[model samples]
Target: MAIVKLSATERRRASAFFTCLILALCAWIAITLSNSYDYQVKEVLVFKNSPQKRAFHPLQSDTVTATVKGNGWQMLFSKMNEQNRIIKVDLSKLDSEAYVVVSTQLNAINAEKAVDNEIIAIAPDTLYFDFTNRSDRKVPVQLVKSVNYQQQFTQSGNIVIKPAYVRIIGPSNVIDKIKFWRTDQLTLKNINEDVNTEVNLQAPDEGNVSIYPKTVQVSIPVDEFTEKTIELPVKLVGNVDFYNVKVFPQKVKVTFTTSLNRYADIDEEFFEAQADLNLWRAYGYSSLPVKVTRLPDYCKIVNIEPHNIDFIVKK
Candidate 1:
């Protein structure tokens, strides 16, 4: 090579060009290293606090979302198998009140590939535990619906339930709110015979609690029958001016329909069947009075078919 001398200005220009080239090469190397091995978000770890000690209500689950950081290569690999990236925290380590930071080492992951990880904060960060045991109670059953007989009918005897009570268990604060569990409302307005129904149990005002038996079987004993005519004691009311006027058929017949259970109790002493003889009084007659009598106390009036009767009287 021939020795070439450079002027001061040209030498400075050449030095600047070399410095620029070296800086560019160092920048390229640094960028390549950063893209290849630098730390970045990868997989996230999540956990629930005090799962064994606290009672979770319905729809409560322990799983939570976590945000992870790692290298681009590691993040790409984790994203390919996203389902496997979830870290499950061991509940056995939970005790007392403390912030449990998820350990990246404990996670079932490639340590050489993982760059960074974080725990996602969730509601109820701290959990409280009471070691006291609880006792279950059997609540008495109640009727939720109105018990009514058909029109002109009456109910008799005791209403019965297959199982008189249901069992309930929960925290005392929750269970104490419940008084009596009742079955769904039943309609008996048109029912004339024994009714058997499956009724759902009521929760009352208890929160986050449930009954052992959600439903109950109820049996309503009923009967339907027609009324029979019976003679009753007669009492005269409202005197008439019909002397020597004798009324015929002093006891009038009255009929109705009711349940058989109540039919046995029916008698002539329950109702008032009467006849008016005042017409005879206007015909110059005296000592004539209307005769009214009561039927049996045990009988119920379903319908008074042809309730009135004609009475023949002579003066």
Candidate 2:
């Protein structure tokens, strides 16, 4: 072992420096352990085990300020390492009307990792809530979506939704005003094949509302459409007080586009071509435009041959 000798003055200086460091460390620890502070831990309130036949709605506030009493070290570490601090609120067998939670009840609320700290005060010291059992109703669902189809393709059948209705429970004033439930927007482009998708429904913007089965399956039937042409008889419409009235080429060709599934259903009876006598004379034109008023919803008119018809009238 080798020993290096130092002067007495150097040794005293070194000893004094270490002694001061140790004293300062001990004083800091003592001060930290003796001091207590109010730590406001912002924690969300969690509701559990709601009463049967009685539904609870929104709470007045979700987050609460829990003022706790603990030493400086305890409070600082808690604030730094705090995960989700929740105050559990059990609503089983609760009342049906609006109620307020007192401070004494808050003392009973369970909070994890807080046993070392004493909860001295809670800001806004009261929790307000509402509950109801008869404010529920069933309403139909409305699908809201934007869909663009590929060229030459069209919808062949209705847009179908499974579980077409939803059950909603909330305040009577709010639920009664909601006649239909709308789904979230689902956008699809260049869609040529059938669409089968599950979509989420929209939740009400207002508070204290609850909805059951918030999603639905949507099926949109689509297919490639074909063109078809048929000949139909043109009939005169509107009252005719004229002495004589006659139309040339009483038959007209009707052209339209429709899905193949509906091709067989398309017939002359499904269409009507009429020339309004009153409009024909009112316009005083050489020919009257033929108007096709009725057609199957699944079909779109492509063109109508002899779009105008020549007529002769005598009065």
- lDDT: which candidate is best? 2
Q: Give lDDT: candidate 2, residue 12.
A: 99
Q: Write the per-residue lDDT of candidate 1 for residues 1-315, one digit (tens) a residue.
A: 999999999999999999999999998866654563433333433343333443323222334443443444454565566655554443444344333433423444334323354333333333223332343688898977776666544444456776898987656666676687778777666665667888887654432344678888887666555566555433343446454433444554456554576666766656675544554444644333333345343344444323343444444
lDDT of each: 0.53, 0.79
Give the Å shift of residue 56 in candidate 2: 6.9
Question: Which whole-number lDDT from 0 to 100 does residue 38 have in model 2?
Answer: 76
Judging by TM-score against the true structure, name the best candidate.
2
TM-score for each candidate, following the candidate numbering: 0.36, 0.64
